[model samples]
Target: MSLNSNLARKVEVEIPLQSPSNVPEQSTGMVHRSISKKSLATRVEKMLMGIIMAIAFTLIAVSISLEINIASTNRALQDTKVSILNTTTINSNLQQEVQELSRYDRIYRFANKQGLKMNEANVRNVVK
Candidate 1:
């Protein structure tokens, strides 16, 4: 009792606890985690792109092959035309030779060489 009377009275301090806020605040930009769900969609998109590119390449290759085939076919057609022209020329020459050989003098000589006697009834007498 004597020591308490001699010392000064001690003072007690109280700190108030912080309370939770009731109003919600909006954020400017928020980042969310969703790796597992987005990964499958990304893989599917990449696979589809690959398939499209492969189809495009195949189409290009087919077109190039078709162009080459067309060129070869055109060359063959030109060769055929040249051969036909040569044949036509030969045919015309043969026709000219046949016409020359069908003359009356040539026919008479050919008949005499063949020992074929010309009948008066068969031979039309032409006063040339």
Candidate 2:
């Protein structure tokens, strides 16, 4: 049994051993692949999408600007209407004053207070 064991040890020791550093290396060259290009229809579609986005943005901006302008115009119109109403009231008061001042009795009393003598022959009645 001892002799058989010694023969087994000798056989194990005689076998060859391989290390990682002693192994052969494979090729490290770059591989080539075919380059693909987009089709004309796909390019055109992308361009049209960009144009549509730009047009949409422009329309939104224009509508907002017009809305602001409309609001401003409405404010101005409201102010004008208020001014016209105030002027109309002032004009009505002035017309009432004119009518009072132009009354025949009022004028006659004023003339009497000023020591004016009435001349029936020279007096003339004016018609509007």
In order of appearance, the predictions have TM-scores of 0.61, 0.64
Instruction: Supply the global lDDT for candidate 1.
Output: 0.87
Q: What are the per-residue Cα lDDT tens digits for candidate 2 across 5-124?
A: 545453345667889779977444421111123455677888999999999999999999999999999999999999999999999999999999999899999999999989999988
| After superposition, candidate 2 runs with Cα above 4 Å error | 1-42
Off by over 4 Å in 1: 1-33, 113-117, 124-128
Q: Give the alpha carbon lDDT tens digit for every residue of 36-113 in model 1.
A: 457768989999999999999999999999999999999999999999999999999999999998998999999899
CA lDDT for candidate 2: 0.85
Residue-level error in angstroms, candidate 1, position 24? 15
- The TM-score between candidate 2 and the true structure equals 0.64
Span of ten consecutive residues with least summed lDDT in model 1: 27-36
